[model samples]
Target: MKTPNMITKSLLLSAALATSAVLCANAQIKLNSKTVGAATKAVKAVTLSNEDVIEYTKEYIQWMDEHNPVAPADDEFAIRLKNLTANLQNYDGLNLNYKVYLVKDVNAFACADGSVRVCAGLMQAMSDNEVLGVIGHEIGHVKNTDSRDAFKSALMTSALKDGVSSQGGTAAALSDSQLGELGEQVANMSFSRKQESIADDYGYKFLKDNNINPWYMSMAFQRLLDLSGGASEGGFTKKLMSSHPDTQKRVDEMAKKATKDGFEKPTS
Candidate 1:
């Protein structure tokens, strides 16, 4: 009953509506695709395998070694660390490698891959026995699988943040920027009080097993306590205080354990 012009107008309106519907549907499909992709990534992040962790950690450590000034083989710090850890090359079931970073930051860390890094500042601050105690503590973290867990957590966070690709069941190589972010996360990582205690116990036993005086454990904590008192808010000393918590109590506990085991504190 309508005129030709009216029919033509109706047809145009229908076409416009149909086009709009198609566009909206396409937009919705794109949004849903994105949501699915993000969800898949999240799942991958959560279900990261141990192999993935080691792979990512290898990349991160390589990045760190490239960025930091590692002590040369002939350097005093390197020589000292090599001498100290010579016998520790094959501790327990883990094959360990030691390196000293020629940095002034008083820090030491061990990775899941049995890579132990000691900072020069820490070496200068403590006696040989005390340094061994600190190294023992780091090794304890590795022995307890805490280092692995920490690296795993860091990898998960980095994967979620950086959208690390995992195509064909293989994790993608991390970009340098992503490696930097991951290194930062690791540098600021903190172990729980329980984990600290466990590592402390392991360090204690590690010293005794190596025929070293366990009194050095208390001495190491005492040195850290002394350093914490003079350290700035952002210094590694203060960070260690915050992460380890109960400094005096831990020192006292180590001292008590050492005394109970009949190990006399050496007077230097």
Candidate 2:
């Protein structure tokens, strides 16, 4: 009675109807509380105010200090950092605080909340002027609002999705696990080439303001390049140079700036 094509069309319609009915029946699947909370926090991260950023950054820095081995006042690393940063306590309206992390990693970072952590390994690898050069660069990120931007990006990740509070009055207290994840994200964060260049200019000016030669900027990068065996492909070297402009280019630029500014490159 029906043609073969009509029969086939009828069978296909029946299958489509069955699939739609199944989907409709399962459309009311429930989400657990954790899923709901994470979604809410993700939304909060997107809407975080400047005050919220500082509060959360404070909490993150506290967590970092608790987890890392901060050098005591009597420690050589602590004394050295204290001396080097004595004049930087109130830099550019920032009430900065400095601490040395007794870690083997040659790294340093500055937080938006005026927190700066320098690793002992970096100090060991660099002279006082070179270390100041590095610290100046870190501070430049804070002064340029680069740290705040980087922190916001870190908070946007799924790992830190549950890290912020959903409340409006204050930043939500993060758990140890959330704080740890946030720390990891911040540590691995990288800046754009433009941001890096701006920070470099800030560092150069910072040194000149402190009456120190800007040659150390080039020296610091040269030391890092040597430590990387001139390879930026992988390992700690990659992390140090992560998403940055070319290392040699940075070295050359700093050298040129120093020369133009009437600072001689130190030869030893």
Candidate 3:
């Protein structure tokens, strides 16, 4: 039995298909079937409202707090992290919030609610500019709405499988435990290669927009490659290499981009 919302969605999809057919027949420039299909799918996908997204974000933050309490805003590392992310807030009218985890992992992530989480180890390992590039990459995820997609996808999957709620239900339908599981799923998600590449490009634009040396993007990747000992695969190296583009390839591209943009390499 299709729910009322499901029926409505089905009708919308049918309409989209009909419209695509008409457009294809009358179009001056031949429309690619793949492009039309992608556009139709984008319209058909079910997504949560902004209010529900925020609710999920708050729940996920609470769960993270329980499992991995954030470093205090006044902590030394936290202060530096804040300083690093300060410039990012005013970009494109986005007032992003920053937090530092006391964890030792060399990773960072962002949330749909404009929340940015940086690991203390990342702060210690990279220079401020290098750290900024990483944060820029994370910000790219939020700016690109990848974070929102991840949250919506995770919540919808859980709701359907776990009977948490209907597609249109408010966030209140999810229990704390279910929200916790959703958060865990979100944290572990590996974004698609295309998405990763887009984020990297966004990060580049971010650094250039702020008048920061964009070469740090290459430097950051090179640093990781060196840390990984340029291994073909294994351990952290595997994780880094498996992230969409090859590590060395990305490093070379960033270097080429810097030169093309008339940004000179730093004197060492």
Candidate 4:
């Protein structure tokens, strides 16, 4: 027979061992998720996440497909977009896709379902490095699942906001304003300071991990900052800021990080 204190100690020990085992298992799962991330439980769970948020994201995508629509597949720029995406190397198993449009708006963006669209203007704005940076940023959106999370938040926001209210009751009732908004926002949304920072981090990690120069992202930010004129008010200069963080801030952050990371020789 065991004394009461011994029994209590034994129970405590067993509980601690069990807790450690569980922690170890969870850590392993997290590490595995980080490595192949494309098909991990969380990855697969993206579709199965039964929360209101995930549901809204899926519903919104379906709504947009049938509604606002995209440029046709036969556009000549579409052909170039295809060429660029096809040659995309160093990124794998991310499940993102790409498209191009002839829109004269001068923009680019990525959606949750692996859909990325580049404007003809954006295509002309970049060389190999800047293009990779923009593409990497888009890929960051996919990797972080920001698209889904944002769509969910935007859906809830739209339902409560004037944007949806003024569209008429029927539009709100049958169609997904959240989804429609997601479609437009994904292409044209500007991230908050925090979101922009996270994307910058992701962009750096992606380029660094892939052995590409992390400075390229900083370089692209500089170009956007210079061309966009960075929030001095008015015209095409503010276009990027309308849907993203101030290019100036992003460039500064990237430059600082790159220097710290030993940007000994930037790409020419």
TM-score against truth, every candidate: 0.82, 0.82, 0.73, 0.59
Give the whole-model CA lDDT for all candidates, comma-separated.
Answer: 0.64, 0.66, 0.56, 0.46
Top candidate (lDDT): 2
- Sorted on TM-score, highest at the top, how do the candidates line up? 2, 1, 3, 4
Please write out the lDDT profile of model 1 over residues 13-115, one tens digit for every residue. 0000000000111111111122337666767767877777666656545545555678999999999989998899988787777777776767677767667
Q: In model 4, what lDDT does residue 150 have?
A: 55
What tens digits encode model 3's per-residue C-alpha lDDT throughout 145-213?
776666666555553233333243543444444544454445334556676678778888888888888
- Deviation of model 2 at 77, angstroms: 1.1
Can you tell me which runs of candidate 4 are displaced by over 4 Å? 1-76, 87-93, 160-189, 232-247, 264-268
Tens-digit lDDT track of model 2 for 143-256: 777787677666677476665654646666666555445555554556667767877788888888899889998898789899888866432345445557578988899999
Residue 248, candidate 3: how far off, in angstroms? 0.8
Off by over 4 Å in 3: 1-47, 159-161, 166-169, 231-241
lDDT of 4 by residue, 1-268 (tens): 0111111100000000000000111111111112233233232333333243433333333333333224467876666666656655336565545554443434455555555555566666766666667666656665566655654344333332332221111222223322333333333234455654676687777777666788888887676666655552322223334445455766777888888988854757
lDDT-wise, the better of 1 and 3 is 1
**Residue 239, candidate 3: alpha-carbon lDDT:** 31
Question: Distance (Å) between predicted and true CA of 40, model 1?
Answer: 1.3
Error of 4 at 78 (Å): 3.9
Query: Any idea how many clashes model 1 has?
Result: 0
